[model samples]
Target: MSDKPKIKVLVVDDEQDIVDLLKYNLEKEGYEVATANDGIKAVKVAAKFIPDVILLDIMMPHQDGVETCRQIREIPETKKAFVIFLTARSEEYSEVAAFDVGADDYITKPIKPRALMSRISALFRRESKKEQENVQVRIKDLIIDKTSYTIDKNGKILTLPKKEFELLYFLAKNPNMVFSRDELLQNIWGADVFVLARTVDVHIRKVREKIGEDYITTVKGVGYKFD
Candidate 1:
């Protein structure tokens, strides 16, 4: 067996068959897998499992995936975990809501296991490459550390959800350079993942909310830049 630790995955859905399908495939791919049939239990399981990735269903009983994702992101242990919403809902609003709650990817499903596996692998592959660059950026009172995935703003350590941290770090790294929404999505989310351009706007707003507007400036008719 490889010495590398298995990547842990949490599969949350109200459907037992879907859970079993994902659990079986994920384990077969050498990941450690955990499952929960409802959002309530999913939160509990995620707190303890601290999975590297969470596959969540949006329409579960007890609570929906959006709320569950929000709660999970609030948890210290799971804040950095990647959340992907796998739902049957195909509405544009559903997709927007998923991204608003910090979902890394959204997929409407007949649940093609092979395609899903590829997407999951792609996420890990991108993350693995990112781990090689252990650099930090300092501007003003803010310190963005890629190694710890945390920010020090005026000596107070602040933690952001994974995507928010990455968006801020990326912009901060290339200060004063304006990047269009499509470019940001490609660079941050990668070409393999299909994310809406509006997702970039949402993330930018969120990063601003956490770190203040003085850092990122929105240029009308253009995109955003780190000020």
Candidate 2:
């Protein structure tokens, strides 16, 4: 067996069969898997499991996935975990809410195990490639560190959700080069993941909210750039 650690995945759904199915398939692929049948239990499991990825369902008893995700993101241990929403809701608002709560990917369910696996693998592959190219971008008093996934502005350190951080870091690195919404979506979310163009705008807005508006500039009718 390879000495590299097995990737830990937390599968959270109200359906037992779906959880079991995912757990079985994930284990077959040599991943360490954990399961929770409700959002309440999911948060408890995630706190201790600290899985690298969390597969969540939008609607659940006690707490919904969006609120659970928001709570999960607040937890220091699970903050960096990739949260993928696997739900039956495909409405645009549902998708937008998922992304707003820091979801990395959204898939409407009837779960195809193979396709889900491919998306999961793609997430890891993209992350692996990113780890190899990690660098810190310092712009004035603001410091964007890809290594720790944190930013420092005027001596105060703040943490952004994974996508927001990556968006900011990407723009800071390129400095002054305009990238359209489609381009940002392709580069940040990757071509393998199907993310809406509005996702980019949402992320940019969130990033700006955290880091302030001085760093990223929106070019009218064009796109966004780090100035």
Poorly placed runs, candidate 1 (over 4 Å): none
lDDT of 2 at 220: 87
* Per-residue C-alpha lDDT of model 2 across residues 83-129, encoded as one tens digit per residue: 99999987888888888888888888899989999999898888888
Best by TM-score: 2
Q: TM per model?
A: 0.94, 0.96
TM-score of 1: 0.94
Tens-digit lDDT track of model 1 for 94-130: 8878877878888788899899888888887888888
Q: In model 1, which range of ten residues has the least summed lDDT?
A: 126-135
C-alpha lDDT (0 to 100) for residue 121 of candidate 1: 82
Q: Clashes in model 1: which pairs?
A: none
